[model samples]
Target: MEKNDLISDLLVKDDELAVDYYAFAHPAGFLDKTSVQEVATALRTFIDTKVVGNQPRRNVILVSHSLGGLVCRRAILDYLELGRSAGARIIGLLAMGAPHLGTDIARIASKFLPSHSVPDMQPWDELLQNLNRAWLQRVVNDGDPDLGLEQRGSVKCQVVFGLKDRVVPTASATAGAYLGELKAINKGHIELPKAESLHDVTYDVVKQFIRQCIEGTRTAPVRRAANVLADRARHLVLQDADSALEWTRYEEDVVTLGPLPAPEWLRCEVNSTRTGGLPSADFTICLALDGHFPDGVRIDYRFHFGRGLLTEPEYAAFGERLKNSELAPQDLDRVFGLKHLYLGVGEAPELRIHYEPHDRKYGAGFALLTYRIQPERLLGVGRTNTLHVCLWSIISRNHGWYSYRATRLVLEKLTLQLIAPFPALELGSSIWWCEPERNEDKIDNDRYSSRLEIEGPIPPGILVQWILDTESAGLSR
Candidate 1:
């Protein structure tokens, strides 16, 4: 690949930085000349002659884009296996838009372009899997004195990926099995390494990584935090049963009303009935469905909190008390970690309550809240089809961190109550709630609506469906 403006800019900005662009010689149509090993051999030869012999003891950073990344990795392994002093000087490796775990695009492309590299880029290819395993083994055994690779200095690897990359997915680009520092840019595969402007976030991130390599700051704080969070989330999943039972008392205190039928809409109310008996603390309520909504119909939602809708002053006062209380900081920190914890309107227009513990130990009395979902948007649409709406995203955000044993669903203009039992959700699984059973009721009343209540730990996502009988309902424009 040709040297781009990003490479030129990096060299211009830093006088100490020296960049060498390596272009492998191979015909695009040739099958036998461009094996990964052959490219790696050429790279190893170049490093031995130009990099090592001339600039001894200098830190060397290998910046590879696209398929060059895999070749570079292989060259590094070859250099290390040779026990050459130059290999020890290699400090950093940055892979941009590299498909380490393979890409489906390569698999599709291979049918037309008969290339050796394309085969290696297939998912679960033996070559790619072996390379990953070797790299992982090296990472795991880094600190061991027996490993000659660590005697000089461990190679710090950072993987940069494009968020909108279609050719190489984030999972493949990041190569999670390697446990390297992963960063993403809001660009596509082709634009990631070519980023030149200072305003470009990818350029800034890559520059920082290069600077760290030069300064010998190998520890990545973001990577460490991510690893820690993953471990914590795993532990939480394992102990979910115990945690669910502990919070069941609070779940019992919550009650739902309404979802009562209204003209072209449905309204539901949820409240905590703890009164002054229990201590005050932050609480979350989530409403979810197990399906998708109708294509043309839009649902409008509104939330009301407290005895009545809380005034600005009352809301601020409640927030202040929560912030100043003794247990507020600790409880908030435990639940949210380093994430910002505050009560505010979320994306789906749900009210998030951050309640402070009152009376020093228990949380305050239950707060009343109401949610209204209006389906008047369905009117005037020519098509009448059954619509499904998945509310998992809405519920997960509003409910904070508690697991629900059951969920309730309410529908307008239907007089029926559905009770469904969902299978026990597995740890770390995103699929938790079951699909709601659809039943047609022949009730004559037009004032009644349908409601569903689920009973166990609330799952992360929920789904619900709506049967749009446009002819009977007269919804045409």
Candidate 2:
């Protein structure tokens, strides 16, 4: 039997209540995509009749991987539209590397490959028509926050992402504001079934999500849901340049939203200043979502924070020095070990701090800071003590010199302290520097990226300082 079949069989025959798994078939091609809702309803009916039919009161837990997550998500949507009483019965949803929002691969495949005609699309296909309309409505009305799980309060959802998954990047795995995320290290996408190391990880994540659902704490967070909705509103309104001219504020946070497609200059202004011994600043984060924020879209913001001025001689020399340094395993470990200083996201978002840049252009490259911004649907509460920041060096093949202008610019803007220095000559302080690792696969093989373990708040001073200082540099507030 195939792994999917084997797993399905194992689930169906489980003697215990908790281990029972019900399998459903998903049709292939665009027809499947079109009629997903009806299919979802049918699958739910089957589960209700065959799996749950008067079998005591065990919670229903849905576990899906890859394309399966899409089917399950549609089912959840159906369960919600069917009403709240039904929603309360769903105990948990666990999706592993599932592209619930949508996938580039799907779009690519649909365009290049002929969408096979499913049985439902053969004749007078009212159901197929309805399904096509439903899918289109889902996409067109995505900015309508009332459309998905975010609006449905009863279902508990969690997602697990493989760090090394080839098919779905770790970043693409998150879409819901309430889902809990588990980063499966060094796991591949398709080969996960054969990889023994993944089962426990999968089980552990599902177990936690199910536990939360049973306990009634796994629903998406209200604040996060609201934020997501607000973002949607921002996206919808910003599409019209005329609409964007109006100032808007949601929940007291001043929001200036606009859409800037690729290669278009993104600009914003902030009012920043030092007052009452603290730096107070307001930021206008110009997002170029352009067309990316679809329903179930999770936008993870990767931020770079460290210390440097825009190209000062002092800072340039420091960058060169960092580029020349070599890193050991210990150094590698420290960079990966740094914790988040402070996160602006909520609903128990998962955060991983690394010294080396991630898959982005800055990854493993020297920068002030870089963060893996993951947004989720479930609520997870935790704390960390270490500050995660990405450090990079400005070693260019053409520019044979260094400068501290960037560092100086930052200093002039924010009253930041020099937390640490590279090549610490003293005891126990040498763990921060890492020379560039030479590897074809590493993201920043040519650039110097180091992880710095620092202690401090996210210095409110910096944002305000940058605004105030940069106003002098050129930008207008």
Candidate 3:
């Protein structure tokens, strides 16, 4: 939080585009010693809270030079872990003479740089090696062999290195950068980030990259991705909900399209396998969500619980687990055999969220989970998005309730599914929906599901209820 000295020295003069810029700096050995990981952690926090806060439509492009590029990479890897998005809305990385590979100058010119930072940039430096290894696996290769670096849909990376630079080697600065994508300049390492004017080659390079980033956000794969997701959302139903959400594995898009927004008619499947705590259920309740974002998201999917049925100790225990670095987000947890399925991953690769356990505040046990629809150019054109949500509850056979809050978004279709064995479900309510245009069927031979293709916006505060008479209400095997 010290004066971000970088911005103090930076002069952004883009007349054609409306863009926002943010920069930060940390204390190094000059004033106070620091490490790249520390800087990266700070940068990650800044990104989540300031740069990308709550704005789904926003996009970010990281522009860094020299050692700062390593800071950016380390910070990125901090957030873009097993199950997180690009730390924030970061759509691209623009590195000017960054050292993904360690620099030869570390030993050759050690006294010229800070004691703490220069050593960390030495060839075969542990931090640089670790950073490069993960970057190669997660950012560069990332299993999508068909897509190019920029087209991967996670973060479009563009690299620029100085041919006349003497500080950081071209090989180090351009490490992990695609060979064909490298932009060579006659500037030095110091000159690459400092443009004399809009006429400077440095300015031209930066300008071109920014323009392409802006244009890319508005066209091509983005527009195509939106169209694809919108068209396929109806088919992207949450059909299979195990302890974790699962789906048939296969490559789909010609472009990875990464994580964009949820599409229209967002198909949601809520399955109640049992009314007990099990590997797939809460101790005494469970409702599983099998849904899709259509294209894909890195991690942006999120939902919360409000002290649901958790005693003070249990609530504290859960919060503790959340803080327990090893059990951080995307690290799955199992309680009574139930798998943590939010932001679902793995072979199934479906967006299956088994929502909250029980909350009486909603007048029903099921919480009304409101999920943000990131309008990340993947939800097609001509559509406005807002809070999207659904809920499922198993209460006394005498009554069950669900609620919806009207928002800027329209309800295209809502699908509700119930999973149970023959005996218990046979005694459950058969015709529950009041909506005339409803369809029902059996799934996996043991589950029952219903669908409603709504025509217009849903009324605000619409509370749905069902009452059924059962001989015995216990869940059947």
Candidate 4:
């Protein structure tokens, strides 16, 4: 499966939720783009609405991932500088795979993808070094006597990271975490925010933290300190600083509670399916349903690449790039990968864009196509919401692929259709829901050829392996 998607929806499954959660969306613009301090201002503005006299009426926890952790930390730091405690409302920050010290991925990605965001996350960048230094003193070290967190506004922080994370190193991700607040798992960076199920380690840790934060035990820190050494015990953890979470910038003309979507978004993956004779993206996704809106949904499906979304001029530029680069016609994905899915979607909610290859320990050459559908638009009449989409891409090959891991959501119905070039071999697939069928003789070599279909109730681990024999069928691999 893919780890690029956000898991904020999973938070809704908690029955004993202590605070109302919000998945903050960043502001849209080049000027207000992925800068750390700017996004922090927007974050502070948003927090203002939820608080009275600069302190929240209820307990708050900030859940952040990657660069978003940085944005949240900067917001808190800005408030501490101004003698206004944003942490009074924000009692706890749950940082998942955040880079407190800059990441090396940003250093390398900066070469092909030259964006200000890259430098912000580099380990040796000045801004990053300063942010960490200030944080260690004022936040972690509790340097200011007048700014007492324990007496007036107490804030707690916890960090969770994987030993195997390829994006942000474990050392950088957990630099500010204390022994009491730190958790180390074996999963990768992308898998840090997720759990195997509600009963797994991820959810268990979150539930315990929620209980502790809501309790507001004043003497908890004293107890933690009693069992301590020099660089040792403390009940609190530190927050994140870079990338996906930005300290959004707001120009004087438009300053409000809303954080706009940035000019360019980090790339995401689309299900490999063929649509409208394009190849049916030969892909299928299984998500759970509860009410009018999808209660818990896990979407990892693909549709064969069609054409739309991109502006005509933008499309032409890519076509020209393909010709001039002297790359094979099938290598158009490489050209799109160079651009980093520049959405440029200023203040608009809809995300319609191109494809890019994933980095940071992902499979090489597997170009990712990203899109977003509004919740109102995605939900349907009853519990089951089936929306047909056309994912436009320049690639032609349609290999067999599927994702088994579905978090938070339950899968009740399953309908899978696999279509490929002729002389295909359907190796092995074991799943049953309603019905199953096969046709070995279905063919048309001229247009686009070969096909397979399956319908079933998905079990825990169902594997399907097949071969289309593209070389013998005169189809591109």
Give lDDT for model 3: 0.45
Please give, for residues 9-98, the per-residue lDDT of candidate 3 as tens digits: 333445576787777766643333577787778887787788878875357778888777888878766655623434465657888888
**Taking the tens digit of each residue's C-alpha lDDT, what string does model 1 give over 1-477?**
243466545545555545454434433322543767777888777776776666665556787777778887777776666653644366678888888988898788778876888888788989888877666555433423345432312577888888899888888988743646888778788887775565467667667777888666323222322332233333332222322222211122121222223222222222322111112132233211211111211112112222122234744555455444433444222212111122211122322323322222212322212222222332332212222211211111111112222221222211223211111111122224543333334333332233433343343112222222222332221
Encode model 4's per-residue lDDT on 251-290: one tens digit a residue: 0000001111421111112322111111111122221110
Clashes of each: 31, 40, 10, 43
User: Please, what is the TM-score per model?
Assistant: 0.41, 0.35, 0.45, 0.41
Q: Best candidate, TM-score-wise?
A: 3
Evaluate model 3: give its TM-score: 0.45
After superposition, candidate 2 runs with Cα above 4 Å error: 1-19, 28-34, 55-58, 86-88, 116-151, 193-199, 215-477
**At residue 24, what lDDT does model 2 achieve?**
68
> Model 4: what TM-score?
0.41
What lDDT score belongs to each candidate, Candidate 1 first? 0.45, 0.36, 0.45, 0.45
Off by over 4 Å in 4: 1-7, 27-33, 50-58, 85-88, 146-154, 178-180, 217-477
Off by over 4 Å in 1: 1-6, 13-33, 84-88, 140-146, 149-153, 177-179, 217-477
